[model samples]
Target: DHLMLYVTNGMGEGIEASLLTNLAINALRNARRAGIPIADQAALADQAVYAHYRGRCYLSVLLFDFDLTNGRVRVVDAGSPQLLRLRRGVVEHVGFEAQLPLGMFEETDYVAQEFEVEPGDRLLFVSDGVHAVASPKGEAYGEAALARAIQSTRLLPAAEVPRAILRELTGHRGEAMPDDDALVVCLDWRGRPADR
Candidate 1:
């Protein structure tokens, strides 16, 4: 089994990264000791972030736990809009329903969900920056754009997936730099190359 937790402050003003890292690490330790599921650990992390930062910063996290035996993927998502699956020739969004971001509420309840992945499946976990792009018409390049990008590269090696998405994101805005911090994570199942 493997667990992946991702947290980023996204170039927010007046933020200290060390504090976030410490809180994440502590929450991870606590989760390990408590022997709880991803949902409980997410709630615990929410409390830690809330108690420490008090909502002065924005936090988005995606927790993924993968079971090697059955190819089951467990997800505990907190206020993120970018979880995608690309299979065959179609791409789909599998993100969690809207939930409170960490540090926004002390008593927020987080839920863990699951997905079944196959050896050739490609999973993408992106930060909000990828969707925070806008055009001259004031429309942000959204999920549809992302799905198209993923579909175009779905059959290639994983190393090319994230790069294609970034290209599509920048393509939406022409020459303008991304207004927000961007992150793209691509995971390829057996025999696929893993890329950022």
Candidate 2:
């Protein structure tokens, strides 16, 4: 279980923020009822148990689950960043096709896709804020940099990849404050023997 978390500043103030928070919670509850497994059960449970405390703050969540016994990987992307999976040295994005962000609509559905995770495969999920970071020269960090960041960490444990990306981003931006929230979740699947 590896998760990267980040949140960015928003232009909306006060009341509007509350509305979005409520909407997001309702949307996630709807997703749970609709059969989308949240991957991190404890975290979701905590959110449900204390949802009232925060009122409604807009945020996104990204989850990654790996079942070593079956070589299956499950991800729940809720208005977060796109998740990338690197298998046998090739990198590709995985998750439901574009769906509404949590809390924006009354009813929403999310699709879960599974891919065989070989012993050396790596997966990376990142928040949009990371890609949104702009350099002094004015170019956004974009997909190319992200892909390269993941590739550099291909041989490391799944948990380290996300941190590597964060470090990379920090190096790129120097002292500037990130414009948005960013998070990364990485999972490395090391298959186990059927009997184990």
Candidate 3:
């Protein structure tokens, strides 16, 4: 069992952003510690944030729980970037129905979706900062560019993928630093040897 979380308060490194981050992290940690089912974990976190911050603060989250024994991953998305999955040298989007960010409402029921992963499959998650990087001409480095970037560097080692993707995004941005914090996480799924 493994829990991976990517959360952003949508505010850039301010005191409020720090508080919101801590709050969300605690809520998520508590939920996982309590053994909440993967499908319901986001809802539990949502309730916590809503109760404390109400409409004042909210979060975009991509939470993934890996059940290694079964070779499955459960994902709960709240207004984060759509996850990318690379398999057989092809990059594909793992689409979700799209849900509102956490704490926007009193009781937001986040839908958790499950997918099966095979050895050699890679999953990528990025923050909006990566998506929002723009060129001098105002053309944003969106999903198409990101997909191409991932494909172009698909041969790199798993640990190098994030930096490689950032390099691609930076090239698109020219000399400008990212206006927002950028985060990229890559998961290389190598099934347990016992399962093989």
| Candidate that scores best on lDDT | 3
lDDT of 1: 0.72
Query: How many clashing residue pairs, candidate 1?
Result: 0
lDDT of 3 by residue, 1-196 (tens): 5645554535446898888778878888887889887557778778887898886778888777777776777777787666788899888888876787878798888778878888888888888888778998899998889989888877888799999998888889998767877778887888877734
lDDT of each: 0.72, 0.59, 0.79
**What order do candidates take by lDDT, descending?**
3, 1, 2
By summed lDDT, the worst window of 10 consecutive residues in model 2 runs over 2-11
Name the weakest run of 10 consecutive residues (lDDT summed) in model 3.
3-12
Clashes (N, CA, C under 3 Å) per candidate? 0, 4, 0
Between candidates 1 and 2, the one scoring higher on TM-score is 1
Residues 8-105 of candidate 1 have per-residue lDDT tens digits of 44225334755665676578568856777877887887788788877765467777677776778787776664778877766888856666666677
> Per-candidate RMSD vs. true structure?
4.3, 6.3, 2.1
Residue 140 alpha-carbon offset, candidate 3, angstroms: 1.9
lDDT of 2 by residue, 39-75 (tens): 4332343254235334233345443455656666565
